[model samples]
Target: MEESNRIVEKTVHTGQQQQQQQMSSSLPATTPVVNPSNPNLQKKQQHIEDSPIANSLPTDHITDVDEYKPPTAEEIRRLTWKRDLRIIPLVFLFFLFSFLDRVNIGNAKLAGLMDDIKITEDQYNGALSIFFAGYIAFEIPANMMLNKLGPRVWMAILLVVWGTILASMASITTGTQLIVARFFLGVAEAGLLPAIYYYLSVWYTRKEQAQKVSLFLTSLSLSGAVGGLLAYGIVRMDGIHGMGGWQWIFIIEAIPTLVLSIVCFIALPDYPEKTGSTFLTEHERKVLLDMLRADAGPAPENDPEFSWKQFFSVFKDWVVYMYCITVIGVIVCIYSIGMFLPSIVRGMGFTSLNAQAMTVPPYILASITILINGHSAARCGERGLHVVASVLLSVVGYIMLIALQGDSLAGRYVATMLITTGAFSCYGSMGSWFTSNFAGRTKRSIAIATINCAGNLGGVIAGQLYRDNDAPYYIHGHGAALGFACATILFSLILKLLLRRINKKRDGLTGEERATIIAEEKADNLLEKHPDFRYIL
Candidate 1:
């Protein structure tokens, strides 16, 4: 008995000594309570303390725990600003022209694309729907390529390929040719949206991502406005070099894309670790990485050896399908608006050029709303409700479109503002919401790709909805979009409730039981399924 007692004492003393040594190295500062006055700082400190690395630290080291100082808010701000300056501009520009290239076809239609090609209304709709065939089919493969080749290389390549295809549209003489060119353009651009989401996920934590994504995706709304102004001016060059005004729109817009592709190759940062030393100092890199690990558990290093098991495991998650369903509705509304707004405006008794220019105000307002919604979501740390609210706004707009009289052009124009603002705002919130929930890169890539693939089907549906025959009011299209918007609200609410229930169930577990489950999950590479992982609603 005495010998056992001696052994216990010795073991306790050794553990205490080891902890002291760790405490010495880990927490040299004497500040017991730094930034206690700021609630955000305190919350951040608590978050780090709850992380796996922090949980592994010796609990007996009370002095070390008290003295520990988390990175200051200023440091985080500075590093974030540095990353934003380098990363967002390039990605934003790429998305801008990619979107411009994609939707400029709408502007081209107003510029007499159909008249030149002699395509009937049904054939014109077929051309639009055909784009999403390549878009949906290539999404998974393209994202797989993004995972294999680093984003910088793959994104630059996509830009070059799509720009070439878009420019070639200027030469197409038949409706079938236009359809073929648009399909290839879709194939090249498939990876961009998912890639941008995944790429931003690498740099920022879940909370920070919405704002960054919002700012980046602002290009979606702004591109419409920019496309309008550009189309307005370019269509005036009808006789320039004997090319049609529609040809000029395609050729002129494709120039920026080809030029920017070179810039992307030269300047775009690959990954946080792969970023140049000049861009992020070693110390800054370490600090940034530490913050990431604390927020989400330790992510694998950039370009970790690909695992087939991880790649295939994405199909097991049911939540991704729910996300897929919700986003479909949002995509339908957005694509319909983007593809047909000019036509709709023209149908309201305006000339084609005037219609092209008028599309600008709705898009500009939508951009402002997107920024505001993203900022609000990030600040409040909520996503589903914001999405719900935005979708509701769209429902209201669609109602107006269906119920408002034909001569109420002014009222219909305001309805377009509501629809554009609501549908476009959902992109950033929805992208960040789900992308943040998945942990591993392979799982994230496949899940994003899958969700995107399903969502792009809405593009196909949207193409069919706003037929030329359903001109002016487009009651059927408006009504269908409204129904889908309500569907979005339903699915979003369901997803939010399901995630909350799961989180609540996990919270009910005993500390030891929770620890055991987390260990098992970590061993099996269960990632976001780990008990400690909480989904953001």
Candidate 2:
């Protein structure tokens, strides 16, 4: 038995040496060697290195292979919960304020912003549309900065700057001033959503991200609900210090955002590998890193240094454009509903204060739907179907809005609930789908920024969709939103089919062919081009 044990140990040691040699060829020889004298530690390490999860990562990316041990299921669960507790609430509040500052113009309009500024409806719409001009222009650059400065510093800077700009809205006396403030506000806020998405991607695996993203994004609906309630109260403060209710709305909302900016700067973790938090033990950190590497494999993009070539190369992918267009459709519905819900409710014959209060319920309903759809997608491991179902629900709501009579107040209100619920739920799935589909951190960053930028163009489209001319049953607006919803469904199906076809082609290649392709791609540092890099459809 002693001789047999010695022979097995020899075989394991030989295998470890071979693996270490293989890894060293692709990466620097920096990994510490495991102590062969510690038999139990050696056995545990060997078991982990042999596991399917460890084998999924490329050798070049396994920096701590000698030290890795597979975390127990309970350990992973507890760690995930701890991460959720630390990250979700703060990020959620940040985005909640971000979204509120963007859409609060709608609340302010109902509180007499347009009349106070002496702007025509067309000019008001122009102000709304122009924000996206700055937002789209800065998104990619902002994400590049976030990658360089790290999430904590970059995001906090953005939050504080935008919060200051958002407050300055209370001081604008002319349409031009309001327009300029809105534009700069857009520029300041541009980096935040995409930055948060990228930050979360680095921390969590593809499977774990959707639900977390949903929780974070629930801030959108919460902002709508909370903004409505706040607006209801603030509007009553009209003429206080000779400022309009709209001005009070801007001032009050800005205060909390500025406070949170300081909190975020101090509290937010940079990245898992660089985190200085006491919440995670050294072993937990190692396990987390290994899990992330295993989930996506490694690429040159994982390196801290920025690559302009890799950044621009994202534009070359047809899949990226598909995702961009798909999100645009969804964002059209979301922005239109979010911007116009108060107006839509007021048109149903409610007073201004009652309309503000009325906006809360649909958003509350939407928030509930978003959580359900997000969790269900994660649980079922499906993306396209859940997104399609949600958008179709919006289409149905739009159709009901068009068909139902204005006097049928309760029914039309139900339709509004459906619209909010459906439109909001699609966001979480679409975000997770696109983020996971892209490989490489730099490429993923640019892809996410581009998609989000394109999607925000929907805000421009939405600004013009619901005009005063289309008053009490805005058939044109409803019809246009319905069309976008259908387009989203069509685009999602096409992308899914295309991905499946590509995955199928990959599966049919022989081992030698795949091996040759992988070697050639690896030589070029084209990680996504590797034959084994499967799409997540």
Candidate 3:
């Protein structure tokens, strides 16, 4: 009995000593943000963002989750920033053009594509529908290729191809030409977003990803709002006087994309080992890497070679299935910005020009909300509630749109603002949720591709649902949006419950039981060796 008491005392003392050590090591070697300081956050914002490639090592390999691993910290930090700096700007440009080219058909519509191209309304829908056909066919393969090729080569190639397709839009004269240009563009652009998400997983721990992703994704909102304004400005130039407004939108937009593609190739900073000259102060670099090592384990040095066994392994979890369905519902409503906002606005009494003008404000509100929620979630270490709040906000907006009628423009306008806010609010939260919950590069890659494919499928359904006959109110489409938003809320709750069960199962196991659970070590949390470690639910 005395010997057992001694053992317990030693264990207690060892834990106390480790806690003290952690507190001390948490202080930076040099004050972080020691140079490029923001006055308000200079002190408290010691937390840093790493380049994505810095953390390619496995997490469970760390000796202890609670104990500080300084060498590991530095390695992860440098790797993460290297990947982030290279990848974010490149993917940002890719999505910017993908979104702009796909949706600007609406801008062209107002500019007279329908009358000038002699496109029948039915055939116009067919041309628009074909983009997703290509989008669907290529999405998974693009992401799978992204997993294999790495961003430096794959993303740049993706940008060049998509930009070429966008430029080709300026030359299209017939409905068939429009159909082919848009379809091939969709195929070219298909893998970029999934690839970005998969690539981010290579560098960041789940907690670190949201704000960085938010910064890039807000580009989508900007494109939605700005794409039209750009079209408006381009169509006004004197040298372009004889060109159709649609042609001007395509030509001018493609020029910037052409330049953006070239810059992205050189500017992209891939994995940490591949990081260019030290653009970041050593202190800043160090803090960023340490943060992710503390959050998710390091990214694998290189993705494991593809195998049929691994490919089939993605079905082992039910979360992947739930997430697949949840994303389908989430994106159905979320796509309102890209797929429907302009059309819905045009359906109102506004002229084609005025309709294009109005799509800007809602997305401006969306960008603001996304930035705020993304940073807030990462800061406070909370994620799900924000999504719930955002989706509920969307549901309320849809309700107002359906109940309030077009007579109340103020109410309709307010609803539009809320819709953008809520949808993107959830989008910003949801991506990180997937990252935070899943483990392993293989599973993460498959899950990302799966969710994205599911989400883009929503675009296919959403496209056809908004009918010309339902104009002014779009009663059926609005109702479909509402139903899907509600479904998202319920599924989110269900997922929360399942995760709680997962946590409970985790908690009930004894150390010996956990260690003996028969899961593969490389794939399981090595940090499970620590009692306080809990999977983020």
| TM value for model 2 | 0.90
Q: Among all windows of ten consecutive residues in candidate 1, which has the lowest summed lDDT? A: 1-10
Q: What range of 10 consecutive residues in model 3 has the weakest lDDT sum?
A: 45-54
Structure candidate 1, residue pairs in collision: none
Best by TM-score: 2
Clashes of each: 0, 0, 19
Candidate 1, residue 460: the lDDT equals 98
Q: Model 1 lDDT vs. the true structure?
A: 0.83
When sorted by TM-score, best at the front, the candidate numbers are 2, 1, 3
**Candidate 2: residue 221 Cα off by (Å):** 1.3
lDDT of 1 by residue, 1-537 (tens): 121122223334444454444344335376355378878768766775644334323332234444454444455567778888999999999999988898888999999999998999888888889999999999999988998898999999999999999999999999889889989999999999999998988887777787888999899999999999999999999989989999999999999999989998989888777776888877577666655654564334243556677778788889988999999999999999999999888887899999999999999998998889998888777899999998888999999988887689899889999999999998778988888888788888889999999999999999999876778778899999998899999999999999999989877877677667756654337677766567888
TM-score of each: 0.87, 0.90, 0.80
lDDT by residue for model 2 over 423-494, one digit each (tens)?
Answer: 999998888888877777788888899999999999889988998888878889999999999999999999
Model 2 alpha-carbon drift over 4 Å, by segment: 1-70, 298-301
